[model samples]
Target: MEFTPVTHVLFDMDGLILNTENLYTVAFQNIVSKYGKDYTFELKLKLMGSQTHETANTIVKELDLPMTPEEFIIESKKQFELLFPDTEVLPGAKRLIEHLHNKNFPIGLATSSSEESYHLKIDKHHQALFSLFPYKTFGSSDPNVKRGKPYPDIFLVAANKFPENPKPEQCLVFEDAVNGVKAAKAAGMQVVMVPDQRLDKRMTTDATLVLNSLEDFKPEIFGLPPFDD
Candidate 1:
């Protein structure tokens, strides 16, 4: 099937590019479980793609935990680092980013993670991957903190950084969760949902395209010729 050409592409960092979402889930569950509260996988799915603070608050309320959002965030981050000392990039993620870089496509990262957390999760090698892109926008850098995922501020910030010609509508966003997809759509950009195994069923609808994995993604699908076979 023919696909619409994209002038720019925006990527979500955590789940879309890195396989850190499950690690996060484990971290949250571990911490919450100690308080005699369970952080189920379904709950993790519900909170995926949200800002750390927002998610922490939700967990606090859901599990009746005795911690403030700030406290929970600090504890969760510590646990996440312990649980996932070595971050793993998703399948085909590095290749896809390199391919886009080689083609000089304007690339950007729009995620609900804080800049510090983003860097911690991405580290040096992944930061090198980011250097290949001309522009980037992180959730912490968003001017409107009140509006994060499911609000389009982050994606809009990234899209606006591109040259004035193509506009947001001409850009494409690759998201791995419902909130990210909503944010991308709210920005008026075409969205491709690369749903993770842990994603909820509700997250699957109304996406411009849905695929099981990035392994199936071909450059030709984005109106670029496939570089391999």
Candidate 2:
């Protein structure tokens, strides 16, 4: 029940740290719409936290779209970049990062996004926001070659980065997607779900803590004061 006991924190980038899920949704819909298929919000939610090719294949099969997975990925990435040229960190993200960094806790970013796309979304400004974190794990960087989200590969990779003797139970994962929660749970880590626009009832049940936003998180939850100053 207590969260402050966590030693390391792992974060999911897109919907969790950066508020870009909507942009992804818009891009997906725009691309699919050109082929006469409707990519509803409900459908987009199903694709959340999935790998680019996986999501594209899902859409292709579901809508019987004509494009190949590779084409879908290429076009979708282009559209997303154009639509979201600027990125913004979610509320409380900077504060939480600073708080954890001040306490010398190791931080990791575990995202299903490709390294190139991830870098594009997180430009120079966004990098400064997360400059304190010492570790990162990307879907493109992992070698296990397993499915993303709803699967534990990404989280497992990040968790393994801790000192060789670290216990899995001591790590905490911050996620914003249902699949991300599932991944963390499968990885045997305590998870906090900070819901963005896509969170639903089913996703909340799997989380150790389901919060409306990171704004409500405080260091005291980990037995520390609100701020050092």
Q: What number of backbone clashes does candidate 1 have, counting pairs of residues 3 or more apart or in separate chains? A: 0
Q: What tens-digit string does per-residue lDDT give for candidate 2 at 1-229?
A: 7564766778898888887887887788888888788888677768778887788889888888888888888898789778665878888888888887887767888888887787788775587766676777777546663788988888878877777535677778889888888888998888888876545677589988888888877656754446664
Model 1 over residues 1-229: C-alpha lDDT tens digits? Answer: 4567877888888888888888887788888888888888778767877877779889999999998988998898798667554788888788888988887777887778887777777674476876786766767546654576888888877777777656777888988888888888888888888997756566688588888888778677777547664
lDDT of 2 at 57: 88
Minimum summed lDDT over a 10-residue window in model 1 is located at 139-148
lDDT against the true structure, per candidate, is 0.79, 0.79
lDDT score for candidate 1 against the true structure: 0.79
- TM-score (all chains, Cα) for each model: 0.91, 0.91
